[model samples]
Structures are given as C-alpha cells and as structure tokens.
Target: MLLQETAGSDETLSLMQLDLDDFKPVNDTLGHPAGDKLLQFAARRIQDCLTSDDRAYRLAGDEFTVISRGSGHPAKAHRLAEALVAAFKKPFTIDGIAVFVGTSIGISTAPPDGTNPEQLMKASDLALYAAKQDGRGRAKAFDAAMLELLEQRELLRRSLRMALDQQQFFVEYQPLAEGSRIVGFEALLRWHHPLLGKIPPAAFIPMAEADGMMPDIGAWVLEQACREAMKWPENYIVAVNVSAAEFLTSGLTDRISQTLDLVGLPPERLELEITESVLLERTVNNIDTLNTLNVLGIRISLDDFGTEYSSLSYLKTFPFDTIKIDKYFITDLETDPKSQTIVRCVVNLAHGLDMQVTAEGVETPAQAEWLHSVGCDRLQGYLVSRPLPVEAIGEFIDRAETSVSHALV
Candidate 1:
C-alpha cells in the first residue's frame, strides 16, 4: 500500500522499523501474561507518537513497523523515531509491575532507500542492525555506507567460523594483583586472523556470541586456561570470562568440572567472570547454573560492576565471590568526587557482603594508592601489566612475586 501510494505522488514514504530492547527479561521475570500486557501498552504508546495519517503495524514479536507519508518524510521520520525512543524511557505499568523497555529505531526513506516494499524493508533491516550494534536505545537512518559495513561484517563472520577450526585463536593472561602480590590472572581471548591480522576481543567476541559460536570458543578458553593454570603455583587463581551466551548454555557446570578434573586444576584456583547482563534474562536458569558452579567450588566474580542498573540488587540476588568495579569509575576517581564516593560505598558494601572487591583499569600509582586505601582487595590494569601470552607469564609471575617479596622485607 505504501509503495502504491508513493508511486503516483511526489511525496515519499518513511519506513521505520522499531524493536523493543530487552523484552525477554520482562517475560522471564514477570511472566508472559505480563509481557503480553507490556506489549499492548507499548503498542499504544508507539501509536501515540504517530500522527493520525500514519499507520503502525505489529511486524512480529517485540517488533513494530510504521509507515508515514509526507513531503518532508525524512524530517518527520526522524522526529517520530526520537519521540518513540524518548517515550519508552518511562516505565510501563503492566499487571501492577513497572516494566522498563527501550526502543531501537531503523529508518529508511523511499526512492533513495528503495522503490518497492521488499527493498525498503531490507534497507530498514540493515539500518536496524546498525542501530542495535551501535548499542541499543538509539535510532539510525539508512545510508549506502551501511550496506558496505554489512558486507564487511559478513566477511568477518565467515572468517570467525573458520577461526576455531584453524586454531587461529589464543589466550592472553592479565595479572590481577592483590596489592603488590600476584593473586590471579584473567584470561583474555585474542584472535589473529589469516588476513585481517590481530583482531581484538572487543571486535570478535561479540561477533562470536551473535554467531552462536561463543559456547565452542568459550569452552576452548576454559579448558586451555585451566590446563595452563595447573602449571602455576597452587595458590594462584585463573579467571576466565563467561559470555552470557556461554553461561546460558546447557552443561556449563559439567564442562567446568570436566576441565578441572582433566587438567588436575583445583576448583578453588579457577574463577568465572560474568556481567550483569547475564542476569537480565533466564533468571531461573542463571541462578541454577550459578548454584551448581558454586557447589563445584569454582569462584564467581561479577565483572564490570557499577556500570549497569541495580548493582547492589545483584549482590543481594546472587552469591558472587567477588565484585570488580568497572573501569569507568576508576578513570574519574581522581577528578570526580562522586567517583571516589561511589568506589568507597561499593567497597564497604562488598566487604559487608563478605565478597572481595577488585578495582579495574587502575593506571597510576595515585589511583592504585587511593583504591588500596579504600579497601579494594585486588587491582587490575595497565599500571600493573598488560595482557601477555602464556609463554611470557612465567617470567612475569617471577618478577611479580619477587617484587612483592621485596616489598614485604
């Protein structure tokens, strides 16, 4: 209908595809009945943003499409997208529960975007992909450059699939120091592509997660890290990051147990680092997995704390062995009084909970001193050491241990 209407008129059609961000959590936590009510409320809210001439259609689960026809199509579409996004910032009351859900909008205009329905939809999808990738709770307009980016992403995805099979991936260990003493090392994944050279974890990790390859890649990391850590002193721990996808996978506890048994690594010497996002969906599954891992004596550390919503609430909900304060707080610790206050409060709270506190991104002696004074149990960042391959860590650990022994004398 939009294509037909635009065929005869000079006026263009603005195609906007909107997706509700993090909707699964509502269903998982509140129940699907609540999710249905939330969707109904969201649909009404979206309709309120559109003019009477514009029409909104439910495209699929948690997805809505709006077509607006006008002379100034792109301008009107931009305004509508912004309005929709802003409106969702407020909580929607469903079944007496206040549910918070944000929106990601992808806009494609007629003619330049596409003349037919299929082309416009595809273009809008590409734009929507970019919007979500850029980070959720945002709006983006379709452009030619996005197509090029999609192509590059596709190539990278293909290469990533073959990466594990070809053994192109490796792990880099960054030491987590307890004051001047080396207590543990965090396993960070690194990929050296045959053609793209070295690809950082930030670039490839998410791609792996999205491609449904994290479970395989993550298992490899766990097995390899534990196997290597077995060679280290029995007192030292090896922390491995667990992606939300990998955490949600079935048999995670069994995998970890198998790894420990195979490598003869003590369960106390292994730590699994997870983020708050992992708790957003599948609450029951996450808790059960954590409980099983807890039983296995593998320590669980809440990574990048104080960066997401309800940091304190997470501590109350789960039995985390440690809380690693996010780097953002540390960067502003000296300049911002609020950062200092927050760090102090978190340290106190973690101690109160009997959980160890690890401060990340500590880059200066002054910063290290301040965190130590505030009762931070462990520190990790460039100030101590950059991530090194397994071969270099033997000497690194020797130097770290020697330095700490000297400090004690």
Candidate 2:
C-alpha cells in the first residue's frame, strides 16, 4: 500500500532493507531471551535514527525494513542507513552484559527502482546482500551491476548442484616440504565449469557454504584426497582444507572415519586443516569433534595463522598439530624487518607450543632459505610447486625426493 501510494503521488519514496551482523553468535552464546531484548533495543535504536516521515518495521529475525517518503528519496534513505549503522556501533547493555552488533543496509527508491512492492523489496534485498558482502556495517544502493551479479550468482548456485553429480569438481595437490624434502601434500579444491571455463574457489566456495552444499562437497574432497594419498609413499600425509560449515556439520567425525576406512588410508596419514573461524561458536562441540579426530590418529592443523586477532587464544584452547603462517606475512619477509621479526616470533612460539610451523606462499629460494634458517618446519607455495593434478604427483614426488637425496649427499 505504501509503495502504491508513492507510485501514484508526485513525491518519490525509498525502501531500505537491513540485516544485523553477528546476531547469530548472540543467540548462540546468550539465551534467546537476551537476543530478544537485544533485538528490541536495536529496533528502538533504528527508529531513533529515522526522521518523522520515515517508518521502520521488523521484517524477520534481525532483518528490518524502512520506508522513507518526501524529497530526496534515495539520498534520505542512504542517510538513514548510515545513521542506523552508526547507531549500532554503540554497545547495548542486555542484562548488564555489554553486547555489540552492526548492520548492513540496502536501499531502492520507488518509481526509479520500482513501482510495486515486490520489485522494490527485491532491489533493496540485492543491495543489502551487496552491503553484507562488502564486509557488513555498510550500505549499498540498488544498481544494475548488483542485479547482474545477483543473476550470475543464481545461475552459479543452480550449476553447483549439478557440478558434483557431473564430476565437474576435482582436487589438486600442492606439496608441503620440510627443508629440501617433501613432507606431504595439501589438497586444493578446483572447479571446471562446462560453460564458464574455470571458476575460482573464492567465487563459488562462499556461495556453496551459504547454500548448505559444502558438507557434500567437502566429503567428496576428503574421500578423493584420501584415495589419492593412498597411492603416495607410506610416510606421506594428505592435508585437506575444511570450511567452517563443513567442520560444524553433524557427524563430520564419523564421516571422516568412514571415508578413511573405506579408502584404506590410515588416519595418521590424513590432516584436516581449519581456520580460526570454525571455532568461533560452539566451542565445546568443536573441541569434542577435534578431540575425536585426534583420538582417531588424525592431525588437526590451524591454517592461516595470525590472520585473526584471537589466534593466540585459540592455540591455548585447542592443541593444533601445526600452524600455517598466513601468506600475507611472507610476501615481503626478506625486505621487511617487521615481517622477519613476526615470522621468527611465530616460528619460535609454535615450536615452544610443540606445534610445527608451515610457511605458506614461499615463492622464492631466498624465502625458503630464510624460512629454513628460522627453523620453520614446512614450506608450501610456488617455491615448492603449484598445486598439481593427481597424475603429476608421482613424477613430482620422485624428482623432489631425488633432489633432497642429492642435497643430503
């Protein structure tokens, strides 16, 4: 009705859609009652930010919508969105607990954007998705580009369902080396779309996680990697990256155990690599799951170390077999004294904790020599070799082993 009225009137109106960021952790950590109070507080704060002509409504589950009428429709809508984001920045005290939350908003002006409710809401929703994708606590206005991206994403989502069935996804193995010797291989997921050529993991992995397709995809990768590793030297291990969604999926441990048994790969020969984000919520369950895998003789690695602020705290909480220093710190290690200092400190710290350190993105001989000199346990990246197809692994391993033996001689 509001959109219809605006369409008939000479004046224009804007619709703004908003979603609260990091709200799920609140519900998971705090009781839902507390979450309710937080939501109420957020609603009041949002209403407070709006002008007299604007109205706010709770759409569903931390999602909100606002209708703004009068002059400068979208401009006023953008201002309201910014104000709302700023409003949430201040902490809300729920039951004497200080809780922090942020919001992402999308805006679409009527007539120019749409004359009907469905079109305007969809435009605003698309804008909202863009805001969230840009890292939350921001606002995005409806644009043709966003619409095109949305269409592309939808097509990709549909294609992803058929991808695994059609065997379009495959795993590539990147060597992880200890000094001159190759210690193991890290399995990297790759996708080759029939029509889209090759799609980067960054483009589709998040979409899979969002659509709840990661568990199946992750399971397939695990089985394939384990089977391939069975063909490698008995002492060599295979490390597979696990997404947070896959890590938290129920029966994940059992699935892995079954896969290892079916593939006739020893649990000790498989390593599961996960980022700090996987332990962000459900810490107890995640710890139990990790412990179960550990009991099965599987190694758990903390990947992309130092990327998150809470990396140190996580180390204290969980006993990770290895920590892979992020590539960001390695890019300028030779030239940057700070990078050298940080890498050295991380290597020392990991060793002190009885955890091995793997330096990723080791692209040059100098970097590898420096990492070796600093007592880094493993090196992975272009310096060792780019990720390889399964058929290439045997030849690469033989060459690497021969090179290591010659160096030792």
Candidate 3:
C-alpha cells in the first residue's frame, strides 16, 4: 500500500525486519501469559517509535516488520531502526516483574536492495539473520556478503546430513580417569569428509542439531559406544553425550534400553551425558523422559555444569548421577582464587547430594592434584588423555595401568 500510494513521488521504501533476542527464556521462566504481555508491550514500543506514514506488523512470534515509505535513504531507515532498538533498552514490566529482551533489525531498501515486496522481505530477513548472528540487538543493512555466508552455512548443512549415511562419522573414546585407574571412557564423535578431510565437531554439531540429524547420529553413537564398551573391562562404564534435540525427538529411553539389550551391555555400565540446555524446557514430558531414563539404570551426568544459567536449579529439578565442572573453571583454578572456591564448593555440593563430580580440562598435574585433594570423583582432559579411536584405547589403558603399578611399587 505504501509503494502504491507513493508511486509517483520521489520516495524510497525501506523494510526493516526485527527479532527479539532470547524471548523464549521469558516464556519458560515466567508463564506464557507473561510472555504474551511482554510481546504486546514490545510491539507497542516498536509501533510508538514509528511515524504516521510508517507502519509496523507483528509478522510472527517475537518478530516484527516496519514498512516506511518516503524514508529517503538507507541512513534514514537505519535511524528509525535504531530508535526502535533504543525503545527496547528498558525492561518490560509484566505482572510487576521487570523482564528484559533486545531487538535485532535488518534493513533493506527498495530500488537498491529490492523492488517488490517478496524481494524486499527476503533481503530484510537475511539482514535480520545477519544482525542476530552478529550478536543481536543491532542493525545490519542488506549486503552481498551476508548472502555468501548463508550459502556456505547451507552447504555445510547439506554435507552434514549425508555424513552418517556415507559412513563418514566415527566415535572416539576419551578415558575418564581417577588417579591412573580408568573408570570409563567419554565417547566423542568425529567426522571426516571425503573432500574436507577432517571437520571438527564444534563446527558441525550445531549444524547437525539445526538440521534435525542429531537423533539419528546420537542413536548411532549410543549403539556404537555400547558395542565398544563390551570389549572393555566388565566394571568400566562408557559415557555418551546426548543433545537436547536427541533427548526430546528420539525415543531416547527405549533406544538406550534396546541398544543395551542388543549389545548385551548392562544398563549400569552405560552413562548418558546431558548439558544444561536439555533441562531448559522444564516441561513435564521432559522431566518424565529423564526419570524414565534414570529408572533404566542408565547413569545421567549433567555435562558442562556451571556453564549456563541456573545450574543449581537443574540439579534440584532432575536426578542426575554426576556433574562435570566446566573447563573454564578448571582453567582459572590455579590463577584465580574464586575459581578454586567455586570448584571446591561444586565438589561439596555434588557430594552432598550423593552425586559424583568430574573435573574437566585438567591440563597440569597441579590442577589434577588440587581436584583430587578436593574430592573430585573423576578427571577428563589432556592431562589424563585426549580422545582416542577404539583401536588405540586398549593401548592407552595398558600404559596407564603400568604407570600406576610403577608408582605403587
């Protein structure tokens, strides 16, 4: 309508796409009613910042679009976008609670960026995506480079989808040790592309999750880890990391039970590691899923503990068998007194709850010594050993056993 009305004028049309940052956490923390109220308040704030000639639309959940005719240039559109962002700098007062969120805006102008609604919206959407990628709460104008990055990410997504079927994925076991005695191995996933050679899990794991491939990949990991554990000492347990996507989408409990049964691996000998993100949903269904998995004698470890928001709440909410102090705290333990205190406190906290603690990323013997002194039940990282392929695990274990024997003698 703005384009039609201003067809004959020397006017420029600018479309701005806006996305609210971390909006789901509000709904998850406060009830959906509060989230709804916050969204309404946020929309009014955006609408209030616009002129009579400009209009705003709630295109979708926590996303809005501003259409401005006669905006003159990209600079003018940017100023309007900045004004909308500034409006969100304050918290939304919902039910007497001050809740916070920020906005990311993507601007696309007509004639230069696009001419029609479809083209303009796409450009603006891509710009919005770029703004979010650039850490949110900012404005990014439509640019050619953003499109290239998006294309590259799409290529990665495609490659990751076929990694499993192509037999390009494998699992490596990192020995989790306690004073030279190998208690178990933490299963890590590795991928080697025919053309790319080796792709780090850090680079592709999120892409796999985004593409909804984690369930299949996670199942394969569980089955493979179980089968491999059958080769280890009877008392040793194998730990496999599970993502939130896999936990929620897959029949994880049934799959674990069945995989253990098929491999003839005892349930007590398998551990499933979950990150704090898995507990964010907090729905009854997710809680039930965790409970069911726990009932099956599968040990559940809260992986990457002390890394995310509300670590203690997760411990209280779910029945976790172990907690892994994040590597950052371990890195700071030597130089920072606060890190030492935090580590000691976590060790005590876990032990108080009858849960074991694992100190991750212990590089120096000093760090290991301090952790062992503080009663950390397990140690994992380079100081212990890097993740090794299945063929190499036996040798690693044998070497560690010999070293322990020498020390004892």
Candidate 4:
C-alpha cells in the first residue's frame, strides 16, 4: 500500500511516527528469513521505546510506531528518531548474513496536530516525505511552515489551472551554443500567475504532470514556443520539454507536426527534451514515438542524463540527437571527483552514440574551459547568459554576434 490511515474521533492525542527505508531490499535481495529477522529486530527496538503506559505497533512490513497518552513533544520524538536512524547505521547480521542500509524519517505530533490517528499520521507522513525529498536518511519534524508550503503549492496548482484558462502562461527562450555560436534555444514556459506572482516552472510543472494536466500545459508551451521560433532569425532552433504525462497521451510525431502546422514553424528548427522518467512505463510505445519523431526531422534530447534509472540502457534503445548532462553533475565537476567521473562517462557514452553532448550549468569560466577540454560539444548556463524574453533576445544575440565577429577578425 502507498500509505495507510485509521480514523478516530473525539480524542486528543499526540502521534509520533518513524519510517524505515531499504528495509524491503534485504528480503528482495536475500530471503524472507532475513526480512522476518529484520522486522522482529525493529519491533524489539520499538518496544524498548515504551515506558510504562507507552505502547508500540509494527503497523505493517517496514513501518513501526510508538504511541502513548499525552501531547506530542516533537523535541523528544526528534531525538528518538535520531537514535533509531543511528541504530541502522551499523550493519545488521541475520544468521551471519551481514546487511547494510539507510533510512529517512518524518515526525508528526497529535491532538492539536490532528484530531484522529489518520490525520495525525498523514501530517507526519508529509513530514517524512519532506525528509526523503531533501535526499533521505535523515529525520525532520512537522511544522506549521511545512503545511503552509503545501497549502501554497495547492493554491499554485489551482492558480495553474486558472492561468491556463486565462492564457497567463507564456514561453521564454534560452539559447544553447557550441562555444559562443548559438546552435539552438530552449523553450521555457513561464507562468505569470495572478495570485502567486511569477511561479517557477519547477514549482508547478511536476504537480501538473502528476494530475495529468501536463498534456494541456505541454501543448500550450509547444504552440507558444513554435510560434515564437517563427519570429526568430532563420536557423535558430527551439527546444521544448515534453512532459512524460503528456508524452503518454500525445504521439510525439503527431504533436510536433500539428504544432508546427498550426504555428507555421519548421520541424527542423524544433527539438524535444525528455527526462528519463518519461521512458519508465510504456517503453515499447515510447520507443515507437521516439522513432517517429526522428523520422520527422525533430531533434530529441535526453534531459538530465545520469540522474535517473536506466541511463546507458535507455541510450542504447532510444533515438536521440543530444544528451544533456544534468547541472548537478556539472556545477561542481572541477572540485568533485564523482561529478567529474559522471561527466566523463556521459560524454564518452554520448560520443560513442555519435550524438552531441551539452554540459549544462556552466556558471564559471573554469567550468566552460573544463567542458571544452573534455570534448563537450555544447554549453548552457548563466556563465554564458541567463534566459531572456524574445523582446530582449535581439540585443543579447547582437552583442554575442559582435563578440564572436571580433574574435574571428
């Protein structure tokens, strides 16, 4: 089950929660005996948590909780959570089979926190989710601010729906280049949200996809980007991101062709950037779509390479023109050995496919130099320029042109 909730009324109770990760992998990789032992061991640890009236429950596989009568003291619960997480740091041995793992925990309180077991648990679960979102293996306490942020997200989600109806979203283009020469530009969608002000794409894009509203948003971005590209200088390409949710609903080839015909933009000047998650489900179907897009002369870019599941395997199977090494790997490549190794591996792999490689997040001259030396074919980041509106693109493009022309002279 994704989650479980139990409701109770007319009770003032404080609930503390803790969740374990990597708990299932032991059984999945070893045997059920190991899993049982792990669960039993966890139950014992939780039992130790009890003092007099306090009681503990092993709710299900990999989930445990301790509850007692009183108000939720997040400080006390937070310390207990640390002790529990620290317990897992050492390897656990079941019948001489040593296993190691890590976990992330979320904390929540009761009564004023929630009226029932379900609501209390739900609030704690949200806190737990936030812990995992911050990169896992740590615990975080529930706060009013947390709920406020979620409420803001919900409000923004509603705003996103209204913005679409009001035509409040628009496209902004950020140019990508092969060393000072513009090869293409990415079509970024901006929401001039009425209530939330200018909402970042990172804020609402995933929420839309999760709700299956991405098809509408994606269509809007594609149409706006394509139409705007028609106004740019000849040979200036437009790259648009295809949401996985939308990709499942719209045929990639058909979407491009129809959008181009509707906007009077050439297909050759269009590129589609797709994240790895897009290929998770419906592999064969997505492959068919990718191949069709290739045949239609639209460039396909692998967005956020090396950051998701099935990187090398997907590259071997999919039709793509470019591989964009994620900014996370490039931002500190010069200082991070892991980042350098990741970038080097991706560059080699993309080159082996005869595909061009673009290192994103080149925010320093040293980073740009490193990428150039390592055979990265393109670069995109603030080190070059920030994303600009079409009205501002002309001046930026002119300045860039003059700089290059002087270098050539």
Best-matching candidate per lDDT: 2
Q: Which stretches of candidate 4 lie over 4 Å from their true place?
A: 1-76, 83-103, 132-135, 250-252, 404-409
lDDT of 4 at 324: 92
Residue runs of model 3 more than 4 Å from their true location after superposition: 1-10, 47-54, 68-72, 76-90, 337-341, 401-409
Q: What is the TM-score of each candidate against the true structure?
A: 0.92, 0.86, 0.86, 0.80
lDDT of 3 at 226: 92
**Which tens-of-lDDT digit does each residue in 158-237 have in candidate 4?**
77777888988888777787866876689888889766588888778878888878887888889888877787788788
Put the candidates in lDDT order, highest first: 2, 1, 3, 4
Greater-lDDT candidate between 2 and 3: 2
Alpha-carbon lDDT of model 2: 0.89
Q: Model 2, 6-125: lDDT tens per residue?
A: 665667899999899889877866779999999999999988898888889898999999999889867788888888888889999989989889899999997888878899999999
Model 2 ranges with Cα > 4 A deviation: 1-7, 26-41, 44-48, 83-100, 308-313, 332-345, 365-370, 401-409
Candidate 3: clashing residue pairs, number: 0
Of models 1 and 3, which has the larger lDDT? 1
- Tens digits of per-residue lDDT, candidate 1, 356-391, equal 999999887778889878889998998888898999
Q: How many residue pairs clash in each candidate?
A: 0, 0, 0, 1
Provide C-alpha RMSD values for all models, in order.
2.5, 3.4, 3.4, 5.3
Model 1 score (lDDT)? 0.88
Q: Report the error of model 4 at residue 139, Å.
A: 2.1
